[model samples]
Every structure is written in C-alpha cells, then in structure tokens.
Target chain A: MKKKWLIGVLLMVLVMSVSGCKKDDQVVLNVYNWGDYIDESIFDTFEEETGIKVNYETYATNEEMYTKIKNGGSNYDIAIPSDYMIEKMIKEDMLEPLNMDSIPNFANIDDQFKDLAFDPQNKYSIPYFWGTVGIIYNTDLIEEEIDSWDALWNPKYAGMFTMVDSQRDSIMVALKKLGYSMNTKSVAELEEAKALLIEQKPLVLAYVGDNVKDMLISGEAAMAVVWSGEASTVIQEYDNFKYALPKEGSNKWFDNIVIPKGSEHVAEAHQFIDFLCRGDIGFLNADYVGYATCNTETMELLDPALMGTTYAYPDKALLENFEVFLDPGDFISEYDRVWTEIKAN
Target chain B: MLKKLSSGPYWLWSFIFIVVPIMLIIAFSFSVPGEAFKFSLDNYKRFMEPVYLKVLARSVKIAVEATLICLAVGYPMAMILARMHLKYRTIAVMLLVVPMWMNFLLRTYAWMTILNKNGILNHILSFFGLPQMTFLYSEGAVLLGMVYNFLPFMVLPIYTVLTKMDNSLIEAAEDLGANRRTVFRKVTFPLSLPGVLSGVSMVFMPAVSTFVISDLLYGGQYMLVGNLIQQQFLVVNDWHFGSAISMLLMVMILITMSIMNRLGQDGVEQGGGNIW
Candidate 1:
C-alpha cells in the first residue's frame, strides 16, 4: 500500500506541472488602461478581423499605471493615461511619438481636443475621451440650487455632501473654492487648501474612490463631487440625480491613448485606435458611459437629446471657466505628501 | 501496503498545494520585477516609509490583543463544556460550533448591519430612551470582528485539552486535603497549556494579517501591513516594493515563530508543569 501511495504521489506531482504550465501561442496585444473605461468586446472584433489575441489589462489609477510601466512593463502595447499624466510620461521620456502619418483616420479627432498643453503639437497621445470634474446631487435632497464649489462645503448641506476621495481632486475643489489655482505650486496656497479640507472633513460622509457614484445613487449622501462621466451615468440611471460643473472653475480631465516606448505591436495598436475612433463605435462607448467624446464624428452621431443634455455636455461659458490640471514637476511629490497628510489626519 | 497507499496521496497533494507555491513566493521575494522581468533591488527600500511601519505595528498590537481576549474568554467556556453532562455537552458543543458553519465574511457583515449608526443596535438604544450610537468605522468594531471570528478556534483547542484531562489526578489532589483552587493550579492548568498555545497560534496568525474585516467595518480608513501589501499589488502595481515589504513581514513572523518554538520545547523539557 505504501509503495502504491508513493507511486500515486509521484504521478500527481508529474501531472501537476503539466497542468500548471501555460503555452499560449496566440498573437497577444497586452492593452492596459483605466478599468471600466473601455468596451472589451472591441478586442473580440479586432481578434475576429485580425487573429491577434488581445490580452486586456486594467489599472485603477494613473499613478498605479505609471508604477507598472516604470517597473519595465514594456510588455504592454498600449496605455490610456490622462492629459496631465501623458505630459508627465513625455517628460519622463516613456512614450513613443505617434507616427501620425501611419494613422490617417486621426483626421476624425475634433480640433478642441487637439494641441492641448500635454502635447502641444499632438505628437504623442491620441485623445480617447474627455470630461470635467463636477458635483452630482440628488435634486430631491437639496433645497437650494447648487451652483459653485463652495456649495459643496456649505454648512446647509453639511454631512449630506461628499467630495472626491482623491487627493488632487478634493484639494483642487477646495483650492478653487478659495479662488486659488487648481495647479497652484505655492506652498502657502496649498496649506490654506489643506486647512479648509481639514475643517470640511467633519462635514464629509466619506472620502471614497469609484464608490462615489454608488454613494450618491444609494441616497447615503445628497451630493458627490465626481467625474462628469460617472455623474452622467448616474443621472441617466436615475432621472432625479442632477449634475453641475461648479459655477466656479472646474478641472477638465482628458484621457488619451499613447504607445509606450517599448510597445512591440504598434501597427495593430494603431489599427485598434482607428477602429475605436469610428463614429458608431465611439458613439456606442460614449452613449453607455455618458462621458463627452473627443471624436467629433461620434458627437454628430449621438442622439440629439443625449447631446443636448446639459450635464452630458455643458455649454461654452461653463467650459471657459474650467482649468486643466498641469503636471507641475516637483510640486506633484509635494501634492502627494500633502494629500497623504490630509488622509492621515 | 496501507502506509504506501496513503503516503503517496498526502505527499502529492501537499507538494502541489503547499510546498511549490511557498517556494515560489520565497523566490519572488528575492527577485524584484524589472523590465522584461529583469531582477533588481529597487523594490526593497519601499517599506522604509513611516506609514507602513505604523501599520505593521498596529497589526501586531491588534492581533496580540485579540489573541489575549480569546484566551481569557475561551478557556473558561471550554472548561465548563468539558465538565458538563454528556448530552448537554453535545448540545453546547453544537451551539458553539454552529456559528463557524456560517460564512466568516457574511458574519462580519452581519455585525456591521447591527452596529452601524442606523443599525439594529442603535435602534434598540434609541427605543430605551438612550441616545443613538455610532459603532461602525471604529477600532472597537474591528477588535470585535476579530474576536467573533476567532473565538471558535480558541474554545475548541482548550476544550480538547480539558476533556483529555485526568479526573483521577484531581481526586488524588483532593485526597491530599488540597482545595479545588489548589488542584486546578497544580494539575488542571498545566495540562491545558499546549492547547492554549495552539489556540493562540491560530488566532494570532490570522488576526495579524487579515484585511477584510478592517475594510468592511472600518471604512478602510487605517492601513495595516496587510493593507499596504494589497494596495501595492492591486492599486499601486509596485510589485518590487510589495515584495520587499512581504519579505520584512515574513522575517517578522519567522522570528516570532522561532521564539515560540524555543519556548514550546522548553515547555516539553519542563514536563508541561508551568500552565498558569
């Protein structure tokens, strides 16, 4: 019996290694980008047309993605990072200049999204989707009309309001309320922003990340300072939920697709990017997600009602009052430190 | 024949499930992931931050407190069970074991349902003309969850020891004109120390590292060492830093286990006499 058991054990170990090994020979496109921000079926279409097997990857935050790419994630063929992150990546020399000549369908891009601060000549990043930060409120809960960033901290809405759980975002809102720059490098301005946040913390329901949409939807909090894309999704789900980019200045955050320095399958990636830029495909993604689109053709193809929704796409006056977050060199480390201190306290 | 048949299956399963993965983690612990999986030392200094150290210390402190509470609460309950009539003892044991049959995460969440500001506990308090209470998102909730989850482990071990205890020895003490207290101190307690050690090991090991309870009840406000490791892997994508921190935690656990082993062997050398 003992000898038989020993034989069985050896057989099992032999079988185990056989099962554990992977030998996938599929043409792999390792695409890493923001989670829940893309339609994965697009990969299936790409695969069906071109037999390149797509390996879909996701990152929750830009910093998290930055860390991966830094640690030799040259394995990834493409990544979508925000405009500021794209700027930081370019400065760090981590991106490849998009051979725009290879991508003729790039003419599909809207002029407004072109020539932004990150890539002045639009050399590196291909703008994927764009939106502004804003307040999402339950119209049933708030008695007064909400217009400005200060309305979030108003004692009248105390304990009923929630700001974004993110460090840069929440601090930016406080900074904007104080009429300071969203990209302020001044330590004095940052300190004042920090103090205002600490004071406002008592009024906060919680500082959370992706849970902002759920929190507002569940009626746990009356308002959440959230990405306009997520706010639009919520307003779509429940008609009573209202969204407003603060009457004061708001930050416009845009995400763009950039090929990293060591991407192996650039041509296929460009083809995939072109496929995404198609009017119907772009409209499908934007219609379900509710983020304003950078694809001019997608906007023209969207339902007139969806296009006209104020929360989905705010007017020009509101757009002018907004600022873009800049990659403020060494100030970011300080920004991170201040954010950590605020969270700690 | 029987030994051969059983031995092969056990060794095979253990090797496949336990030995190989542990070896992999230890290997990965040394090699930091670089571009194209190139090795580097850049990940090792990641946990030097004060934030991570505080969290590790907090985990250790909370685990120790939970283990101690389990010891104090479980030993007496187990003793009473071991002394009960057989039929009643079976019923009591069933009752004690039933809570374990439920899902641990589900049970922890139930505590949240009862303890949140608008939860059952607060509603009861308000009904009694007392003010409403906020019990969720506090350290007390975390400790409570830990104890509730681990109490079964504490009680079962000590019960095993107490049930195996020789009643003949107790009678012998009584015959020598010794009181119950003296008998217990001299005989009963020493016999159960091994069970106490086992119980402590089970509760202490898990409580020190578990992150789910804190996340669910405490709003994940405070980071423990476990949380740091999770954030590195899931959120930060800093595997090298994560590996370095994991190596530190492994060393900490090893040092603790070595001391425990030495003390445990000393216990054997002393004939298990110093139970109290």
Candidate 2:
C-alpha cells in the first residue's frame, strides 16, 4: 500500500510539472534553426513524403540558438546558423561534417554559393540563402535620391528612421558613413562609430528587429537598415518601399546549414538538407520566405518583380562594394560591453 | 553520526548547485577580461559604467514596488479567505489557484493579445468611446505581467498563516471594547507577519530574476537583471562577466533575504500554519 501511494504521488508531481501542450509526439526529428529562416511547407512535405515526424523549433537570434545547442547536451540533430557561427562551431568542433555523397541534390546550389569564405574548401556547412546588408527605405516619403550613405543620417528625416539593433550592423553603418571599411579592425574607427551612433540614437524611434517589416509597410517608419532578404519581403507588399547598397559599402552574408556534433540521426539530417535543395523545393521555399534562392534553376522561378528589384538582386557594381562580417572572436565581449553601455545610456 | 549524515545531503546540494556556480562566476569576474581568454578583473571594473548601474537600480526599484503591491493586495484577500468557513474557504482558494494551471509562458503571452495596440483591451476601449493606450511595451506592462505571474505565490503563504489564527483572541480583543481596526492592529496583523515574510521571499526573488515575460511583453525595450545576464552569457559570449553578474545578483538577494529574515524573526518564532 505504501509503495502504491509513493508511485501515485510521483505521478501527480509529473502531471503538475508538465505543461502538456505537446501532442505531435512520435519519434521526433528536432530541427533547430534561426527564426523565419526556413520554409514551413518543406517540413510538411518532408513529413508527408518521408513519414518522419519533424519537430521544428526556432530561435530569435543566433546567440539564443547557440545557448540551447550548447547546453542541451547534444540532442539536436540539425541546426542552421550564419557563416561566422558556422566557422566558430567548426573551431569548437561542435559540428559533424556532412557526407557530400549522401546529399547529391546539393548540386542545385550555384557555384558562387559554394566554397565560401566562412568554410573555405566546403567541409562543414552548406549555404542556405545569401543576402547583402543595405538601406531599405520608403521611397515616397523621401524626395531625394539615396545613392549614398549620407541619406541615412539626414537631419530632415529625424524620427523617421530605424536601424539594425546590434553592435555589428549599427557600428558598421557609422564606419561606412565615415568612409571607412565596413569591417574596420582599427579600435579608433570603432570608437568613432560609437560616437556616431550616440548622435543617431535620439533620431531612432525604436531599435527593432522583426517588427521592422510590419512597421515599414504600415508607414510607421520611412527607412531602416535591414537585411536584403527582409528588404525583399517588405518591398513585395508595398510599392513605396525600396532598398539600396550605400555608395560607400555594406556587408555581404550567407546563412549555412550544418549538423551539430553528436547528432543521432545524421543520415536523416543530410537527407533533409538535400531534399530542400532540389530545384522545385528550393523555388517554393524562396518564393514563400521571400529570400534570394541559391539555386540557379530556382532563381528562374522567382517572381519577376522580385527578380528585377535592385534591392533583392543588386547590380554587380553595388555587390562589389560589399564586405563579409568576420568572426571578431575575443573582441566580441568588448562589442557587447559597448552595446550594453549604449542601450543603458 | 545521523546528525552529520542528515546535514551532508543538503550541504552537497548547496555546494554543487549554488555555491560552486557562484564561485565560478566570481572567478570569471576576475579574469583578465578580453573578448576570449587571458582573463582579468575588467568586467567587474566595467560594471561601474553608469548604464549598468542604472539598469541595476531600475530592476531593484521595480521589484520593490511589485513586492509592496503584492503584499497590500495579498494581505487583505488572504485574511478574508482565512475568516471564511472551511467548506467555502477551500473552494475559494482553489479558484484563485486554477489560473496557474496554464503554462507560465503561455499565460504571459496571452497578456500581449489583451494589451497590444490592436489587442482586445484597445478594442473594448474604442467601443466605450475611450482613447486607446499602447500598454504592451511600457514599464507598467512589465509590472502587471510580473504581478499576475507571482500573485498566487504571495497569496497562498499569507493565507496559510492567517487561517491558523484563533478566533478567541480576536473575540477577546473585541470584548475589551477594541474596534475591528484596533483588533486587527493589536492582534491579527502582527500575528500574520510570518506568512507575509514567506510570501515576500517567494514573490520578490522570482520577480527580480524573471527571464521571459518582460522580454515578450515589452519587446526587449527594457533591460532588467535577467536580460543583462542573458546578454552577457549568450549574446556577448562572455561567460566570465556573466558569471560575475550572477554572483552579484546572488549577493544582492542574500543581503535582502537577511534583512527580511531579521524583520520576521527568521519566521521561526512566528508560528507557521500547517501545510502538510
């Protein structure tokens, strides 16, 4: 009787501790990725075709995803991160290299997307989507041509602007505005950028991320420092919206897919990446997510409006002026401290 | 000896989970701070920045204000329930507790649908010919979210102690021509202080360290202690300073706890209502 009573108490504690909203519980294939970075239908299609119950989870920022992936004790099967993160993960040896022979459909990816800077020689990661950092604007709200970086800090547009809410992007803007390289390694340039940001902070309505799309479309903002892919999405919904690579310079970036080390189902993970990279699937994914697809065939299926939009696919001259964000390593803490100081101020 | 063995398990838990983590944090705090390694004590020195101090001060102010409101609202509600007959009292307390059945994150997120610019509260305000207020990303929203999440914890402890009061003592006070206010001041209120201390401890610590609700509802517009620690460990990739901040927060909480314990006589000499 005592043993039965003890078992009953334990079960009650389990029940009380549980939140109990999970119903899609079979053998779960957990795929973790950055927020709004994947096509939902691809997961559904994978489920229907392969009969694997895919559990899709999202993280708002790269750091958040890393925190869970680090502390979760190797349970995640598949993860996606930006290029710099892929480099760091490889250095930490936290990822297992993909077996390229198992993923033949990866051939659909354009040659330009392959063997990129973050993973020279292409050992650990596969490129997902590539974009350039630039100015996304409300063309109707501004009367002047915005072919230069000065258009962002114009006094006439005070309280009418937004910018990326991060040390890297915001500081890069100041660096470029001052005619310096976007990836300025000089501490003097960074300090100058910090001062420039302090000047611009009051003019900012809010430092926002995901809300930029809704706010820009609704006319709450006239311009924002935005990702090219996000700029593409918002531009499709409103004619007045447009984006450009500042005449000075900008950052070029690509997100990549990789398997975290100690993945239990490496085969399924590679299969998923391969399946999504096929021409039709890649096209659908690009169309739905409103990002530039890396596949050459998928590029043809893109909406002509999106195809012709200079912001989505910048002219070669503009693309040439872009620099990739290198992993700043130990300097990251200083970057964080400076950012916290800015926010607190 | 059984006494030493009995203390051993608790000591082990404290050392492993609590003390060791705090020590690790302190060590990280003293590292020759760089982006990566070759550590120093710069993070602690860096903590002297006015912005960090402002964030710390704001977190404390908000936590203290929430604790007072929880106490003021909780004390009366707990007393009334305590005065109720046994059958009705049980049902009343359970109703207050049923809202906790929902997931904490889900409950906090639900507040967004009610307080956002286009949310239900504004919709009702428009219908009533009142001006709509954007409440979602403000400091008030953070307080309301914390209070809602933690009120029950405050209520239950106070209620448990209030219910244990002998009716005869109140009757005795009234027989001496003392009015209800005097009876409460002289007899009931002083006696219920133990429950208030327990309730305060339960509510204040969690409110100060709240991680998710404030971020979701306020859209990360405000920085509290938890968000600061989160930024350090995750975004900045600086676990050393992050650990130091954790240690600092722990020390602050310990100091507060000691002060509270002194006020409540360690809540031991004060009688506890039976929970088991």
* Model 1 regions more than 4 Å off: A1-26, A156-158, A308-310, A328-331, B1-64, B73-133, B148-185, B201-212, B223-276
Q: Tell me the tens digit of each residue's lDDT in model 2 across A13-111.
A: 888668453543445578887777777877788888887768888888777778778767648878878877787778878889888998898788889
What does DockQ give for each predicted structure?
0.19, 0.27
* Cα lDDT of model 1 by residue, A1-345, tens digit: 776898899999998888765455556778898888876677777788878877888988887888789769457888999988899899989998887877776889899889998888888988889888888889998867777888766778866766665668888998898988899999999989988987877677666676666557656668888888888788877988888778778898889988888888888777777777787778777876678889888889987787656577777777766899888775664575566456545
Estimate every model's Cα lDDT from 0 to 1: 0.78, 0.78
Candidate 2 per-residue C-alpha lDDT over B1-276 given as tens digits, one digit per residue, 9 for 90 to 100 = 769967998999999998897766677777754444456767777777788889889888888888988988888899889878999999999999999998998899789678866678998999999997767666898899988889998999888877777889899999999998899887887788778888888889888887676676665556787888887877886777787777778889888888877767743574764221
Which one wins on TM-score? 2
TM-scores, in order shown? 0.76, 0.80
Number of the top-ranking candidate, with DockQ as the measure: 2
Worst 10 residues of 1 chain B by lDDT: B267-276
| Candidate 2 Cα RMSD (Å) | 6.0
